[model samples]
Target: MIELKREGDVFVLRMDAGENRFHPDFLAAANEALTEVERAEGPKALVTTGAGKFYSNGLDLEWLGAHQEEFVPYLESVNALYARFLELPAPTVAAVNGHAFAGGAMLALAQDFAVMRTDRGYFCLPEVDLGMSFTPGMSALIQGRLTAPVAHEAMLTGRRYAAEQAREAGIVQRTADEAGVLPAAVELAASLAGKDGGTVRAIRVGLYKHVIAALRGPALPE
Candidate 1:
C-alpha cells in the first residue's frame, strides 16, 4: 500500500490504501519503504502523502477488534514508526492531501515539515471526542511537537483545523491548493536534500531526544 517515487533527490512515499489506516500490512509497507529510503546512498530527502481523500484516518479499529490480543504490540509498532520519522537521516515532509485525524495527525507532527491542502481536509485530534485517551508515547509526541497553548486546546477540545488555521497554530508550516500539496512538499524537501544526511539525523535526534525516548520507551504508561 505504499508507492515509492523519485523526484530528483527527493523520495515520495504515497500511501495508496484507502484511508491509510494503520493495519499490519499498511504499517509493514510503510516501514519497508522507510527502510529503503534510509539505506539509499547519496543526497536524498523524503516526502509522504496519501492518495485521494485521506491522508490517513489513523488506527484500524476493525482490525483491532478482531485482533485484540495484539493491541499493545500493535501500538508499540506505531510508536516505533513515529520515532523512525523523528530520527530519519534525511529531511522529511508530510504532504497532507486530506483528512489527518487522531494518530494520523500525530504522524504529520512527526515530520520535520508539513504542507497541507487548503481547499479541503482537516487536521484534528479527535481522541477525546472518541472517548479515548492518548497513550504515554502519544502524549509525549504531541506535547513535544506542539506549543503548550496549542497542545492544550487541541488535546482538550478536539478542534478540527483547516489548513490556514493549522498554519496559524504552528501545526503545519505551509498550505497549498488541493493539487499543489505534494508538489510544495516535494519542492521543500528537494531544497533541503543537499544537507548531509548524517548531520541532519544528529540534529533532529538531539532536538527531539526526549520525544524519541518516549516513543521508543513504551506505548503505555507502566
Candidate 2:
C-alpha cells in the first residue's frame, strides 16, 4: 500500500492502509518503493504523504491490540523499515496532510523534513501507553528534533497536537492550511532541487551517514 510517482525529480510516495492495518504486504510494497527510489540515482527528493485524510493513523492500533502475540515481530519489522527510511541517501520530506499517530508519526519523523497541514489531524506517539518505549534508534532523532520539554510531553502524555504546535515544538518544519501544505512542501523541494545536485547530495548523504553508522555498529553481546 505504498504508491510511488515521479513528478520530475520529485518522487511522491503515499501510504495506503490495507485492511486498516500496516499489513505485511504493505511493507513489501514499501520495500519496492525504496528500491525504485534508489534506482532513480543522482540527486532526488521525496514527498511522502498518505491517502485520504490521515498522513497515517500509525500502525493499526486496533490490529496490534487484537494480536498481542505478534507484538515483538511487528515492532522488529517496523523498526527495520524505519531504519531503512532513515538511511536513504536522498532528501525526504513528510508532507503531512492529516493525522499521524504512533508509528505513523515516527514514520514521518524518519523523513528529512516534515511539513504539515494547519487544519485537521495531528501527531502523537503513544507507545508509552502500550507499556513500551521509543525504539532506542528513534529516541536520538526525537531528541534532536524536539526540545526537551516538548519531546518529554509527547512521549509521556501520548496526546496528539496540531500542526502549528508541532512546528512550534520543532517536530514539524512548516505549517500551512490543508490546501497549502503540499504546495509548501513542494516549494521546499523546488528550492533543494534547484541547488547544485552534487552539493545537495553531499549534504544529504553526510547528514545520514552518522545515523547509518550507528545502525551498522557492533552489537552488544546478548
Candidate 3:
C-alpha cells in the first residue's frame, strides 16, 4: 500500500508494499497520490520513499507473466508516470531507504535529488542480466539523468552500487545512515519548498523537453 501525508512544507509519498513493484494497482495509487500533490496550494515539495529493505524491486515479473498481452500498454503507463515526475510542479527528492533496482532506480532518477541509505541497500539496473532491454522511454530517462560515462557503465555492466559508490558516481546526491534517509530527504525537499511551483515546472518542462517528449511519446521505439 502507498500512503501520502504532509510534513510541514513537504509531501511524503511512502511506498509500503513489500518490494513495491509496479503492479497495475500500485501504479494507480501512485498516480492518485501525485494528482493530490499537484493540486495542493502554496509552497510545497515532495519526498518519495519505501518501507523495510526495498525502495522498490521494479516491475512485477510474475504479474507480467500472467498478463503478457497487456505489456505494451503497461509500459506506456510506466513511461507516462516517469513523465509526470519530470514535469511535476514541486521540487522532489527520493529517500532511498533500501535497495532500488531497475524501474525503481528510474523512479529515483526522476526526482530532483536522492538521499540513499549508507550501510545497506544498493542502486542497480539489472535489465541485461535479466535478459530484458529498457523501453525507449526508460533509456531516455536514464541517459538524461546520468552523465554519459556513468549511464553507459550502469546500463552496460548492471553493477550494484552501494550508497557511497552511487554518490561518487552521481547517482544520488547524498548518503545517510538507514535511520536518517527519510529525515535527510525531507530536509532537502523542505529547503526547496519555497520556490514558486509554476516557475519550477516551467523551468523543468523547458529544460527537459526532449526527455519529456520521449517519455510521453512511445514506450517502444517505432
Candidate 4:
C-alpha cells in the first residue's frame, strides 16, 4: 500500500497503484512510514505520490459499510494523521498523480504544498454527493488551507476540479504531466529541505494552529 524511498535529501512516499483508500491497514502502513521519516537523521523533506490511477479515492467505503462500529475510531486515526502532516518537522508536498477525492483530497491539503498532474486526474470533495459532510476538523483543515471562496465552492458544490482549475483556485501550487508530477514534487521538497527542521515546524504550527487544534479535538455530530 505504501512504498518509501529516499532520493538524496527527500523521501518519496508512494502509494501503490490502486484506489489507495484509507483502510485500517493503509493508515497503519502510512503512519509507520511517517514514523520512519520523522526519526531519520539529517536534513530531509517528504514527497507523497500515488503510483497509478489514484492518489487516493478516499475512505474505504466497502470496509466501513461492513464495519460501521469502527467509524469513530477510524476517523480518529485519520485526524491524527492529518495533524501529524500539518506539523511534520520537515516540509511536505503532495504529488497528486491521479484522482484525489473526499478524504483523499483532505489528505493532500494537509501537506505544505501540492503539485498535481495536469493532463488527467481530478481533485474533488464529494462528501455532499455521498450523503455525508465534513467534520469540524476536516472543515478547519480545508478552510485554513484554501481561500474562503474556493473552500465554499469545493465543499458546497462538490465540484470536480481538474488540475488547471485546482491550480487556478490555489488548491495546487503547480501542475505537470503525469510523468512530471512526482519529479516536480521531489524537486520542490529537495529545494525546501535546506530550511531548519525546527524552524519549519514551528512556522507551520503557528500558521496552522487552529486547524491542528480542530483536527486533534472532538469531531462534531454527524
Candidate 5:
C-alpha cells in the first residue's frame, strides 16, 4: 500500500512496509495517489519514501515469473509511471530510507531530487547481475539523469552505492541519517513548492523530451 499524507505544501507518499515491490496493485495505488496530488489545489510538491528496511526492492519478480505473458504490459505501465514523474508539475523528491534496487532505484532517479539514508541502505541497479538488459526507455532515463561515467559504471558493473558514494556520483543530492531522510526530502520539496506548476511542467518536458519520448515509446519484446 502507498499512503499519502499532507505536510504544509508537500505531499508525502509512504510506501508500505516490506520490499514495496511494484506489483500491479502497488502500481495502481501509487498512480491513484499521484492523480489525487495532481488534482488537488494549492502549492504542492511530492516526497516519496518507504517504511521498514527497504525503500523498495523493485519489480515483483515472483509475480512476473508466474505470469510471464504480462511482461510487456507490465513494463509499459512501469515506463508510463517513470514518464509521469519526469513531467510532474511540481518539484519531487525521493527519500530513500532504505535499500533501493533495480526499478526502485529507477523510481528514485525519476524524481527531481533524492535524499538517502547515510547510516545504511544502498542504491543499485542489478539488471546485469540478474541476466536482464535495460529496456530502451530505462536506459534513456538513467543516462539522462546521470553523468556519462557514473551511468556507465552503474549500468555495466551493477555497483551498489552507499549514500555518500551516491552523493559523490550525483545519484543523490543529499544524505541523512535514517530518521532524517524523509524530513530532509520534505524540506527540500517544501522549499520549492510555490513554483508555477505550468512553468515547471513545461520546463521539465522540454528538458527531458528525449527521455520522455523513449519512455512512452513501444515496449521491447520479452
Candidate 6:
C-alpha cells in the first residue's frame, strides 16, 4: 500500500510492497495518493519514497505473470501518473532510499529531482526486457533530461545502476547515505519551497515544450 502524509510544508508519498511485489490494490492506492498530493494546494513540495528496503522492484513478476489481464490497466494508469508529474506545479523530489525497477524507476525519474541512497539500491528500466515498452511520455522525459548516451544505455541494457552512477549519469542530483536519503530529499524540496512557485512551474512548462518542439522532427533552433 501507499501512504500520503503531510509534513508541514511538504507531503511524503511512500510505497510499501509488503510481501507481494505487485499488488493491484496497492497500485491503485498509490495512484490515488498521488492525485491527492496534486490537489494539496498548500504543500510546497513532494517527497516520494518506499518503506523498509526497496524503493520498488519494478513490477511484481509473479503477480504480473499470473494475472495477465491486469497489465493493461496498470500500464495505462501509470502513464496517467507520468502525465500528472509532468504538469505538477510544485517542485518535486524522489527519495530513492532503495532500489527502483522499471515503472518504479520511471516514477522516480519523473520527479523534478532526486536524492538517492548510494549503497542501498539502484535504478533500471527493464520494460523492453519484460516484453513491453516505456510510454512515449517517458521517452520524452528521458530525452529532455538525460544525455543521449546515458538514455540510450538504459533503454538498451535494461540494467540497474548504483546511485553514484545515476548521479554521474545526470539523473540523480546527489547520493545520500542510507540513513538520510529521504530526509535529504525533503531538504532539497524544502529549499525549493520558498521560491516563486508560479515562476518555477512556468519555467518547467516552457522549457519542456520548447524542447519537444524540436523533438517533433527537427527545425533549426529559433
* Order of candidate numbers by lDDT, starting with the best: 3, 1, 5, 4, 6, 2
What are the per-residue Cα lDDT tens digits for candidate 5 across 184-217? 9999999999997768889999999999998998
* Superior candidate under lDDT, 3 versus 5: 3
List candidate 6 stretches off by more than 4 Å. Answer: 19-22, 60-63, 209-222
lDDT of 1: 0.93
Cα RMSD of all models vs. native, in order, equals: 0.7, 3.3, 0.6, 1.0, 1.1, 5.1
- Deviation (Å) of 164 in candidate 4: 0.7
Give the clashing pairs for model 2: 58-104
lDDT of 6 at 183: 89
Q: Write the per-residue lDDT of candidate 1 for residues 1-222, one digit (tens) a residue.
A: 899988889999999889989999999998998999999999999999998989998998899999999988998899999999988999999999999999899999999999999999999999999998888888988999899999999999999999999999999999999999999999999999999999999999999898888888867788
Clashing pairs in 3: none
TM-score of predicted structure 3? 0.99
State residue 122's C-alpha deviation in candidate 6, in Å.
1.1
C-alpha lDDT of candidate 4 relative to the true structure? 0.92
**Candidate 4 clashes between residue pairs 3 or more apart in a chain or in different chains:** none
Provide backbone clash counts, one per model.
0, 1, 0, 0, 0, 0
Residue 81's lDDT within candidate 6 is 62
* Poorly placed runs, candidate 4 (over 4 Å): none
**Residue 176 lDDT, candidate 2, scale 0-100:** 88
Superior candidate under TM-score, 2 versus 4 = 4
